[model samples]
Each structure stands twice: as C-alpha cells, then as structure tokens.
Target: MKIDVKVPAVGESVTEATIGSWNKKNGEFVKRNEVLLLLETDKASVEVVAENDGVLAIQVEAGQVVKIGATVGILDTEGKASAVSSEAPKTAPVTASQPTQAPVTSSPASAHLSPAVQRIVTENNLNPSQIAGTGKDGRLTKGDVLAASTAAVAPTPAAAPAKTEAKSKAAPAPAIFAASGKLSKQGEKKIVPMTTIRKKIAERLVEAQNTAAILTTFNEIDMTKVNEIRNKYKDKFKEKYGISLGMMGIFTKAAVEALKAFPAVNAYISGAGAGTEIEYHNYYNIGIAVSTEKGLMVPVIKDADQMSLAEIEMAIRDYALKARDGKIGVDDLTGGTFSITNGGVFGSLMSTPILNPPQSAILGMHKVEDRAVVINGKIEVRPMMYVALSYDHRIIDGKESVSFLVKIKEGVEDPERLLFGV
Candidate 1:
C-alpha cells in the first residue's frame, strides 16, 4: 500500500514553506517518526517527519517551494520491509578491494567525489585524497580542498628564492597616472538574496508602522539604588541560584508592578457589541524581544509578575540562548500582552522603540552611563539609564502612558517598592 505524506500545517496563517533539504533520499527505507526533510518557513525551519515505516519516494527536491497540505512524498509500506531484508545481506560488508576494479573513474578527475569537491578538483586539477577532510564521515570541506591545492602547487625551498626573483623582474612596474586624466576603475558589486525570515520581518515592521498609532515617551531613571542592590547581592545571588542577578529581573519586576497600577497600558483594545473596550488582563505574560541571526523573535514569560527575581533572570537567559540557537518554537514567539527590549545589551544609549502590534506597549531599556544628577538637593555622579515606553496612542493616552513610565521609574529607583508592592 502506498501512503501519501503531505506537508502538515506548521502554524496559523502559514500557507507554504521552502524545502531546505532532505535527509533521506528516494527509495530509502525509513522508520516511523524519522526526520525526512527540513522545511524553512518565514518564521522558522521545521523538520518533516515520516509518519510510518516505509520506502520513501520524494516528489519535491530541495529548494522547491511547497504549499501546506501538498503531497511532497509517498511511502510504499509493503515493498520497503521486504526489500530491506532481502538487500541487507547482499550489500553488507562489501570490501573496497573485493575484485571491484578501481571503482571506474570516468575521467582522471572523476573519482567518487561530491559535486562541490568534484567541481573544485576539475577546475584546479587537484587530487581529492591528498586533501584533509574535516567534514563528518571523512568528507572534504571546500577549505580543506583549497588549502591542499595551494600546498601542492607551492614551490620547494630550493626553488623559492629564484622563482621570487624571476617573478619580481618579469612583473610590470607600477603605473603613475595623471590625477586630472586618470580613469577610475569601477568595482564589482555582489547581490545576495534575503532569507525568508528577514523578508517576513521587513513585512511585519512595515505593517506595524501602518497599523499602530506609535508614540514614544522617554524618561531617565537613577540606577544608583538598583546598582547598589545588585553589587551588594550579585555574588551571593549567583552562588545561591546558579545564575547572575541582572538588571532585567529588577526591571521586569518593576514593569509588572507598574502594569498593575496602570492597567490600561497592559490592556488590549477589542471591539464587542458595546463598541471597542479595554480588556484588562490580571495575569502578565511579558515578551522579551531577542534579536537572532534568523530575525527578531519575542518569547513570552508566562505569569512573569508572579515569578521570583531569580526565576525571571534564569528564564530570560534560557529563552535568549534558545532564540539564538533557533531552538525556540512558533508557539513561544506568540501570545504576549507586553514586550521589553534591552537595547543596552548592544550598547545603545537611547532609542525610540516601535510597539509590537496587537499589544498596547513596548519598553526599550538603554545603556547605563554615569552622569551628574541632583540627589536630595546635593549634586552627585550616579549611574543612570534612559527608558522609553512606546505605545499605541489610540489605546494609551499621554497621561496614562507618562504615568505608567513614571511608575516604572519610581519602582526601579526604589526597588524595595517592588518587594513591598508600593
């Protein structure tokens, strides 16, 4: 019986995907739940798994664009098991020297070589075996082959000095052109195609700009108190919890408290029979915007307001590492009521961040710098950071927005307020 293997729905609204690569080839026997191919979508690269044990017959090749529900392969269930059992004994333990006449090289260049390695050998006339392979299963990398070619053509020590002298004497002398009459040579430019994730990010950014009423309100916070607390407890915190207590924990706790006070900033606007109303959520799921090579992905920390400072720090660290490694899922990137982006990590002094759509607000945290500021009528140098809260003006008014940021500023400045629920 032939079983149709169709592309499963990856996520909501994702219609199609590009075939990144296939792990198993046609006619190969595969087991149930085995990874058959990798499919790259606008958001992520997902592995297509085999549904049952069978002989695979791929309908699509790598780099082909396929839609959701498209039949990309078929599995012949009845023939596979029998074929594997029959062929295993015949092909097993076949020795390289078993009277198999030098595996017929079509050309002096045409040994058993990969397409890329073969091309390099044919173009440069280099032997494959001489190249040191760094790839898995003793395959040669492009770098290894190129390096071997250079080593093979290098002049011997006895011939080096004479060759260098001859080349220097034969080479053309430097040409000095008149400045007024000189013709400048144009350099070649290369165009590389953008990845699917990058294209989607571009589209989403434009859509965000068009859809939301973005308004940025900036405020500077005296990090003196926060820094003092961190410096005093950082060693103990790391030793006890196995994670460093960073500013994110302090800021996240503060943000959550501020959200509680200014519920409108944390709420989402939706239309009901009575018209558009503010839907305030008691639970806080804060999205931490992390930048990755693939694109910008935001992973939410569910019920962040209820988590301890140590837990929040650990969660942020885990999510950040996963995001960079591309191990984070589509579900992790969705469903957030608010977002916090740390531009300070990249050494940003100040920036007006744009709001992530469907949500009301996004907080941008900038780098800390030491400057002079008034402290109880006395001027002192202290660590300070500028925080910008960008919100949808349609949902959050200026008073509510400013007050919301002020609450954060106050909480951060006096972190003990977070402990006391002030």
Candidate 2:
C-alpha cells in the first residue's frame, strides 16, 4: 500500500507554502513520524513528518509552491530499504616490520548523509567522519558540514598579505579610481527570486499601509524601578524557575495589563461604515516579534494574562529558539490580540512599528538611555526608555491609544502595578 503525503493546513490565512529542503530522498526509507521535509510558509518554516515507515517517493521538488492539501510525496509502505554493502579492503599481507597504512576507503558516514549534506561532502571531497554531527542520533546536519568545511579551509596568507600591504599603501591617495577588478565587481548584479516568507512579508506590509489609517503615539518611561526589580529578583527567579529573568516578561505583563484597562487598543475594525464592527478579545494573547534569519515572525504567547512572569520568560525564550531554527509552527503565529516588539535589542532608539493586520495596535520598545531629570527639586540621572504605540486610527481613538500607553508606562515604571493588575 502507498500512502499520500500532502501539504497540511499551516494557517487559516496561508493557502500555500513553498516546499523547502527534503530531508529524505526518493527511494530512501524513512521511519514513521520522522521529519521528511520542511514547508516554508509566510510566517515560519514547519517540519513535515513521514506518515509511515516506508520508501519515500517525492512528487514535488524543493522550492515549488504547493497549495494546501496538495500531494507532495508518496510512501510505499510495503517496500524495503536498500541494503548498504560493506567490503573489506584488500591489502598485501603485512610483514612484522612494515608500518600499517591508513585504509584507502571512503567513510561509511556517507550512508546516513542527507541530500544537502551529501552534496557538500561530495563537492569538497571531505571525509564525513572528520566533521561532527549535531542532528538527532548523531546525524550530520547541513549547517554542521558547512561549518566544518569553512574551518577546514585556511585562508591563503601569501596572497592576502600582499593585498593588505597594497591597500595600506593606497590609503594615502586623495582619490581612488576603480580598477578593472573593482569595476567588474561594481557592474556585477544578480537577481534572485524572493523566498515565500519574504514575499508574504512584503505583501502584508504593503497591505497594512493601504488598508489602515495608521497613527503612532509616543511616550517615555523611567526604568529606575523596573531595573531595580529585575536586578533584585533575576538571580532568585532564575534559580527558582530555571530560566533567566528578562525584559520581555515585564513588557508582556505591562502590555497585558494595559490591554485590559483599555480594551479598545486590543480590538480591530472588521468592516467599513455601517458594516464596520469592532471585534474585542476577552483574553490576552500577546505576540513577541522575533527576528529570524528568514524574516520577522510573531509567535503568540496565548493566555498571557494567566501566566506567571517566569513562565512568560521561558515561553519567549522557547519561541525565539524555535523561530531561529525554523521550527515555529502555524498555530504559534496566529491569534495574537496584541504585539510587543523590542527594537532596543538592535540598539534602535525609536521607531514606529507597523500593525500586524487584524491586530489593531503594536507596542514598540526602544533603547533605555541614562539622562538627567529633575526629581523633587533635585537633578537626578535615571535610565529612561522611549516607547511607541502604533494603532489603527479607525478603531482605536487617539484618546484610547494615549491612555493605553500611559497605562503601559505606569506598569513598567512601577512593575508592582502589573503584578497587582492595577
């Protein structure tokens, strides 16, 4: 019997996905529930597992866009895996005085290599045994092979030093004219097709600009108290929960509290004019905008209001790790009532965040700077952070937006307020 392997429904809005790398090749035997390939959706990359233990028969090639429920591959459940042969190396009988020579045979590691890993190994004429494996059951991943290849090849110092000396001598020149080599590089241009994730991001950004009456409101919060609390409790928190205390947890708590106080900030406009409807959420599902190498992905922390500070930190950490590794799923990307993006990590002082459609507002956290301010008629230096809330003006009134931000500012400046749900 043959089993059909079809593209699963990744998300409610995502109708199609690009077939990413196939871990198993056609005619390769895969175990049931083993990851067979990756499906790259707009938001994240999902792992598609084998339906049964069988010989894989891939129907779609990598990088092809397939609609939901379309067949991607087939599994011949009744077929047996090909057996790999091993033969002893033939050598002349060794005399007692003769030193043993290394075996002139390829590493058996090739037997377990994936298509991507096999390509690299073959290209570089590398012995897979020399490289370390980081994947499951000591299997070599593509990244592991690439890293090993890079480390194995040392730069040619003989040519590099001469080029460096020439560049140093040319540094004194008033103007540097482009040589033929430089001109060649300048003229070099290559067009590459955008990945599915990048295309979807571009579309959504343009859609957000076109559909919403977007407005940004800004405020500054003193971080003196928040900093104190974290500094005081971070060690104990980590020891107790096995996760470090982080800024995202505090921000998530504040955002959830503020959303409760001003529910309008958590609502979105569904239609226009008489058909317009303001859909409000009773529970808080806050998204932490994570930037991965592929693109920006917002994985929601569901029912955030019910989670503790330590749980929020752990969840954020897990989301970031999964997003970085392209393991985040469709369910992780959807149903966000509000979002918080910290540009501070990237050293951004201030910026307006674009809305994630259907979610009316997004809170942007910026770098905290030490500045002098007057307190009780005395000049005091304190760490202050500039926060911005970008809201859909159609649904969230300016007054509501301002109040919502004020609540966030209050909760952050005095985190005890967030704990008490004030």
Candidate 3:
C-alpha cells in the first residue's frame, strides 16, 4: 500500500513554503511521526513529520517551492515493503571485463535531487552511486557532488604544453597593477532580498509614517529604587520561579499602571467625528518587540496588566526564544493594544520607537547611565535611563503624552507604587 505524505498548512495566510532540507533520504525507512523535512515559510520554519512508519519515497526536492497540501513523498506500508524491494532493478556485479561502466537508465528518484546537486549531476551525466555523500546521514550534499564532478573533469598532466617562448612584443604589462591597491575588498556591499517578516515590517513602518500624526515625548527615570528592589529580591525570585527577574518585568508593570491612568493613550481612534470618541480597552495586551536574525517580530503578552512579574518575565523569555528560532505562531504576533521596545539591550542611548499599527503608542527603553543629579539640593551620582514614548498625536495631545511618560517615570522610580497600584 502506498501512503501519500502532503505538506500540512502551517498557518492562515501562509499558502506556500520552500523545502529547506530533508532529514531522511528516499528509500530510507522512517518511523511514525519522525521529522522528514524542514519547511520554510514567510513567517516560520516548521518540521514536516511522517504520518506512518514506512520507507520514504520522496517526490519533491529540497529548495523546491511547494504549496500547502502538495504531495511531498509517498510511504510504503509494512506489507508492501517486500514487494517494493523485489521490484528494484538488479545490477550486474562489477568485474574487469565489465569495466564497471555507468548504466544507461536513470532512476525516476533522480528527479527528486536538489537543484544545486541536480544541475551538476545532469551536466556531467553522473550516476548517483558513483559519488560519495557527505551531508546528514550520508546523503549527497550539493558541495559533495560539485567536488566529485571537478575531480572527474580535471586536466591530466599529459595534456600540459611542453614549452613556450616569452613574447618580447607583449604590450607593456598593462597598467592594471597600479590600480590593484585601490580595488574594493570582497563583500564590501551586499543586496539581499528581504524575508517575509522584513517586508511586513517595512510596509507597517511606511503605513505608520503616512497615516498617523506621529510624535515622540521623552522623559528620564532614576533607576535607584528599581535596582534596589531587584538587588534585594532577584535571588529569591529566580529560585522560586526558575527564571531571572529582569528590568522588563518592572517596566511592564509600570507601563500597565501608566496606561490605566492615561486611558486615552491606551485607546484607539475607531471612527471619524461624532462616531469617533475613543475606544478604550480595559485589558492590556502589550506587544514586546523582539529582535531576531531574520528581523523584528512583536509577540504580545495578552492581558499583561493581570499577570505577575514572574509570569511576565517567563512569557517574554519564551516568546523571544520562539521568535528567534522562527517557531512563533501567527496568533503569537498579532493583536496588541500597545507595545514596548528596549533598544538598551543593544547599547542604544535613545530612539523614537515607531508605533505598531492600530496601536496608539509605543514605549522605547534606553540604556542606563550614572549621572550627577540634584538630591536634597546636593549633587549626587544616580543611575538614570531615558525613556521615550512615541504616540499618535491625533489621539493623544502633547500634554497627555508628556504626562503619560511622566507617570511611567514615577512608577519606575518608586516601584512601591506598582504594589499599591497608586
């Protein structure tokens, strides 16, 4: 019995994916639920698993574009394996008289070779068994085949020219030598095609720039009190929760309080004129902007205001790791009322964060630096961080935006306010 293995739908709006790599080779036995291939889509990379135990008969090649539900391979069921094995072609044993010459017929399975390897094999008319594989589990890699082809076609010593006369008339050894030092180094510039997430980010940034009256309000917070709390309880918190307590947890709590106090900043502009007053959300789903190798992805922690500090820290850590590994789901990256981005992690001093679309505002956190400040009319060194709030000016006035930032500053400076909800 032949079992068809098709590509499963990864997520909504994701219709196609490229075969990243195959974990198993054609004709190899695979177990049920074993990962067979890696599928790369616009948003994530997922493992394609075998549905049943059988020998894999791959129909598509790695790097080939396949649509959702497309057949990638066929599985030979238990009872049919013996029959399939019997049908395989019998080869004449190698001998001096036979010369071990290449066969005339090529297996249909050859059509499933990766493009890079396929091109080299077809151009050289090489047999699959002739070259040794070096990829995972001894599968033929692109580099392996290319190297094999190069060795086979290399010029022999007998074909070299015996002797040659130096030409005295050769044009003055061209002035090209003088320009060698001025040439640009290798890979000085590169133009890579944008990935799906990057393209989406570009579109969103442009939309935000064009649609909203964007404005940024800045304020600085003294980290003295916040650091004191963390230094006092970080060890206990980590031991109890199995996770480190970070500034994000403290900041998230402060942001939630500020959002509650300035309801208008948390609100979105739904309609125009009489129909549009302001739609305020009672719950806060804060978007935490995470930087990944592919690009920036914002995964929301739903109802963050209701979560404890430890819960918020764990959720952020989980989402960040998932986003970096390209395992975050569509639902994880959507639906947020506000966003927080920390450029300080990358050593940035300050930046005006762009708002995630539909969300009225975004908070930017910058690196902390020790600075002399007036304390009781006396100058003293204090750890301070500059915070910037970028908001839609149309919805939030300058006063409200400034006040909202000041509220966050106060809450962070005196974290006790977070406990009492002052």
Q: How high is the lDDT of residue 232 in model 2?
A: 95
Alpha-carbon error at 260 in model 1, in Å? 1.1
**Residue-by-residue lDDT tens digits, candidate 3, 1-422:** 77898888988888987776666656778889998876766666677788888888778876578999999889987633433222112223456532333643333434335533553564454666667676655666667776777776654454333211222334343333334434344423435455455566788899889888999989999999988888999999999999888999889999999999998888887776423567889989999999875578889999998899999999999998787555677678777899999999999999999988889999999999999999999999999999999999889999999988998998899888999998
Assess every candidate by TM-score.
0.71, 0.78, 0.72
Per-residue error for 305 in candidate 3, Å, reads 1.7
- Runs of candidate 3 exceeding 4 Å displacement: 1-3, 18-23, 58-66, 78-183, 186-190, 270-279
Candidate 1 stretches greater than 4 Å from native: 1-5, 23-34, 52-57, 74-187, 272-277
Q: What is the C-alpha local distance difference test score of each model?
A: 0.77, 0.81, 0.78
Rank the candidate models, highest lDDT first. Answer: 2, 3, 1
- Find the candidate with the highest lDDT and give its number: 2
Residue pairs with backbone atoms closer than 3 Å in model 3 (clashes): none
How many backbone clashes can be found in candidate 3?
A: 0
Against the true structure, what is every candidate's RMSD? 9.9, 9.1, 9.3
Error of 3 at 150 (Å): 18
Candidate 2 lDDT, 1-422, residue by residue in tens: 99999999987888998887666656778899999888888777878998789988778767779999999888999987553221112224667543333332344444466534654654444567766688776777788887877765654555578668877886643223354334444453546578788898899889889888899999999999988988998899988988888888998999998998888888877767533788888999999999875778899999999998888999999999888667888899888989999999999999999999878999999999998989899999999999999999888889999999999999998887876788
